[model samples]
Target: MTAPKPRGGDILAIAAQNKVNWSGLDQTCINAIRVLTIDAVQKANSGHCGLPMAMAPVGYLLYTRFMRHNPKNPEWFGRDRFVLSAGHGSMLLYSLLYLTGYDVSLDDIKQFRQLGSKTPGHPEYGVTEGVETTTGPLGQGFGNGVGMAIAAKHLEARFERDKSGLFDHRIFGICSDGDLMEGVASEAASIAGHLGLGNIIYIYDDNHVTIDGHTELSFDEDVCKRFDAYKWHTQVVEDANDLTALSKAIEKAIKETSRPSLIRVRSIIGYGSPHKQGTSAAHSNPLGVEEVKLTKEFYGYPTEPPFFVADDVLAHFHECVERGEDLEHAWNAKFAAYSKKNPAEAAEFQAALATDLPTGWDAELPVFTPKDSLATRVSASQAEAAIGKKVWNLFGGSADLNESTFTDVKDGGDFERGHFEGRNPHFGIREHGMCAILNGIAVHGGFIPYGSSFLCFTDYARPSIRLAAMMELQVVFVFTHDSIGVGEDGPTHEPIEHLSSLRAIPHLTVIRPGDANEAVEAWRTVMTHTHGPVLLALSRQKVPTLDRTKMAPASGVRRGAYVLTESAGRPPEIILIGSGSELSLVVDAKAKLEEKGKSVRVVSMPSENIFEKQDQDYRDSVLPPGIRRRLAVEAGAPMSWYRWVGLDGEIIGMTTFGASGKYEEVMKHFGFSVDNVVERALKLLAR
Candidate 1:
């Protein structure tokens, strides 16, 4: 389809227009993005340039003509969100952000991919003002956009009244063939379609070019048909540069408010590059010196001076600032009136936006005692019920393992089609997509999102988990069946080395509660934590709660590790450390060793990461240097225990897969028993 002609019937005619907004200045602004992208990538001598050049018109139309965003206030809650899911084209987003009057400066664009520069290799969330979430990991951002759509629907249901649209912002994004090909994106798309997330509108960049070669060498499915199968409102703009067609497609999508929309834009890679357009050559590399000049000439741009933006194009894009201010000003006025009518809901909305925990949110949390012998997962469910009631904005679900993971809230209705008011979202069996979506919800603000799965299944969600840690998102990841305790499910279900591997991720706090009360405290810590993602590795098998009347209070969980019980009247000769279900073993072993006239101290070490953050004085007080005989017992790999158990200490942990049997039998077979703990402590003392 051809672009609609200007009023004077010429491509370069300077004329005003209506909603289509087709003009020579619009084309100039679009080319400005293309040229700036080429300059940034060419100057860096690194980064992808193809998609930016190919989809410059697509991106320009969204930023300037369609998307309701505030360039000056990027965090305006009422503004629509735009995700560059095809984030390797970071220069594309940078150019749009700069031209549209965001905080991104010309020098920042010049420092693309440089250390400490806002324009990093990928579009990061906090580093750039307009970037909604971190991208460049392909399908992760796709899942994130769906998550944002979910968040929007949920907030709208809870807060909006009388057709007021305070929470009616849409999630706009540009995805690619690589993104669609990723398994995570497929999973996320399936759920988004199922939930009828009408707030999402993603443009597929069908440029057919990958780093290895054209996508035909790998991807060849009918993308629009596939989305149709997923219940999406699908459309295709045969020409990427056909502005009139693309605009109409998007307008039609906005009218269809029952399904998410996907508009396939058949584009050419390196759209205007003289030598490399429509080829793999321009996908990831700089267009070289001569190709750069030729490309500028192709766009009718000056060749010598790079990163140049015409004054008219700048002025054209800056119009977003005034438009955004007007839009926000009107919304603010409506919100002020809405606040008077619905004062309680308005305050709740503001608190959620600030991520502030309400007072007494945990007032109802259970304090388990020795009489309570329950799986940590079960305790987590109980704690969630109490916190969910007061927190009000705690949203999450399990990966089709709600029955086993025990993350479901009793009264929290299922978040289904047309019922987004429910807090418990059913994520089906998509672990990776669930985590990526949780990141999206967290980054979207006004909600604390979480997802749960079996500990062994976290391997499937590792990439998203790593991204969450990288982004420092406030997401809670709950993983049950934490060890050999998975029992009859056998080695495939058990998580060996999972704890140690997860601990290796920076900014991620991994906690395995020793008992029911510690599980509650872990939830408390998770609710208060704001810096990064936290993973709770809970046990499926029952473990006895410590009698806090006789032992240290469970509040010590905030300290990461504490002396649950120490040798009576003296410094302990031997120290026993454990976490999760294994904590019970050390508690029993400490009792046995004390019977033999040995001074024994038992410490509950739930989170090594959080513990390590403590001051040296507090750390020394917990594990006094004079005592070197330490024994650490757990059902997982011993790699993470070596640091806690010094050269003279011993760690009793699994070196092999667990057997299929009862949980108790399986645990003993893996040497996670009280007898094993006692034996290891004795040997350490003898040494």
Candidate 2:
């Protein structure tokens, strides 16, 4: 094969890069993949066909030879992970899953992009049996692979000391031009290189065709040089069809046990399509019936039967089923032997795999008192350190905000290149990549992953955060400096609407603790949460811890909201609600209101998301139906409080960006003061 002209920098060539002959069976299987992909897109009438057509050889080679995955048991603990980073080319994954004997059937392929089908337009994690993580919004899967690699490294360090090879699986993926162009992927790639995650190996399909036309229309960076600069092992393959070259590249990548690998392969977009071979037309649109027939003729395939699979091809692919079973059986035996020698470690590993917290995992959790006046972020840090000691499976770090976010686990060592045994991972300043990586870690299992940053910076990580909620991963997202309380940093650092915006995402639990004790309870809830992602928006300024002896216990935080102090001798004539740092205002205001001979109730509502999940009777009990004279106070957008506070009620919140000053000054400026709360409640009661 002739080499393409070198782009910007010197091409990093691989060893043993020579022409290796292919048999009829290999060629037939590769074409079967191509044929099935095109047929699926053609039938669906809406999907990308070009990538599958172009990268069939690499996909076939990886599944058939390189990857140690069991088709029969997609969730086999010892199986290697395969991420389809170029999720737009989803047909490539579905076809492979179907062919390799994963639960995906030919009928599933025909149902591509159809409602309720396992084969969605993009690869969804739980929807498909084999898909490792959800991918589609370009570069997310790339970051996810890095996370999986990190998980593998950590697990291997913890459990593979006996050389049982139980946790030594690698992460393989196929990425497209769009993926590399995305900032998330770039950030993830840089970190992967920095950490020297050798278990990750991704093949870049340099087809040069995107939905907008050729990649040259915009992207023209020297990808190999860039990766090399990131400290990754890079290589170039002139032809995607050169299976031998692809094989050798993968072999070299596997042997380079210190750095991640990116093999860039140049190939035609729509490999066999005669008319639109290298153009954007083939990138997303289906190959028309006539053109498909012409493409099939090019592959020496029968044109009459679309989605046809030869007997030899099926026979060849089904081998993975038996091979996978044997692989699992062997690993089971090794695990049994390891268990005999190390029963405690074996049980711990098993418990982690089952996502079961150990006995007394919460035994050491911090319990705060009214005397502990501290920032919620500080309390959260104490809670994490205590939990981190017992729940060894809880692993994560902040995105260059460790000090600010107060997410450091006390004695937990840093997770670095050579020290994968550490539980704390320094995610640098890459919030976008950090959240996506956290999702990857959560999906990989064996760990309850979390990532932190200032609440305002959730904008950088929103896409991944949304996906985490969508996938229903049990991830804890800790965001500190949650409001204008991040004073002097001004509006850019203060998260004015962040709480409301995060609450908008379905299945995402947003918790902003009212005080130190509540912060500890919030962490308790976070550790026990299993359904979906949870975001903890903690305070940068200290909050007076409510005296549980005089008020409702902090355990009420688990129920999401509770009445802190109830009215005496009557049902409340006026109700006061607050969350996070503003809870103090309502507490103070309640005393002032009672002095006016009004029956007042003060409720500390930390998490509206969790409260809404309670049954009607419970919800009504917290915010009584008769009490329309209610006032809600928070240092954030009032949008989220509308449901809790009736139309007759009022909210003390920031309507404009906060000014740079002391936190107290900022709060007073934004009308988040006790006087404001008292005034609002009086007016509502008068009405």
Best-fitting candidate, scored by lDDT: 1
Backbone clashes under 3 angstroms, per model: 0, 0
Report the C-alpha lDDT of model 1 over 1-687, residue by residue, as the tens digit. 222232212211211121234777877888899988888988999989989988898898899888998899999999999999999988999999999999999999999999999999999988999999999988999999999999999999888899987888899999999999999999999999999999899999987778888687988899999999999999988667778988999898888889999999877778777667767887999999998988787677788789999899899999999999999999899999999999999998999999888999989998777889999999988998899888878899999998898787778798999999998899999999999999999999988899999999999999999989999999999999999998999899988989999999999999999999999999999999999999999999999988889999988899999999987887799989999998989999999999878999898999999999999999888888888888888889999989887887888888888878999888877787778777878877887
Residue 577: error of model 1 in Å?
A: 0.6
Tell me how far candidate 1 lies from the true structure as C-alpha RMSD in angstroms.
4.1
lDDT of 2 by residue, 1-687 (tens): 222222222221221122337987898898899999899899989999989988999999899888988888888888889999999999889988999999999899889999999999999989998999999999999999999999999999888755778888999999999999999999999999999999999999987778887677899989999999999999988878788888999999989889999999986777777777777888999999999988898788888787899888999988878888888899889889989998989999989989998788778878787788999999988888888888998899999988788787777788998999988899899999999999999999898999999999999999999999999999999999999988999888999888999999998999999998888899899988998999999999988988888898889999999889977898889888999998988899889988988898889899999999999999999887987888888888899999998788888887888789998898887787878787878788777
> Distance (Å) between predicted and true CA of 183, model 2?
0.8
Candidate 1 CA-lDDT value: 0.89
lDDT of 2 at 667: 81
List the candidates' TM-scores in order. 0.96, 0.96
Clashing residue pairs, backbone N/CA/C < 3 A, model 2: none
Candidate 1 clash pair list: none
Q: In lDDT terms, how accurate is model 2?
A: 0.88
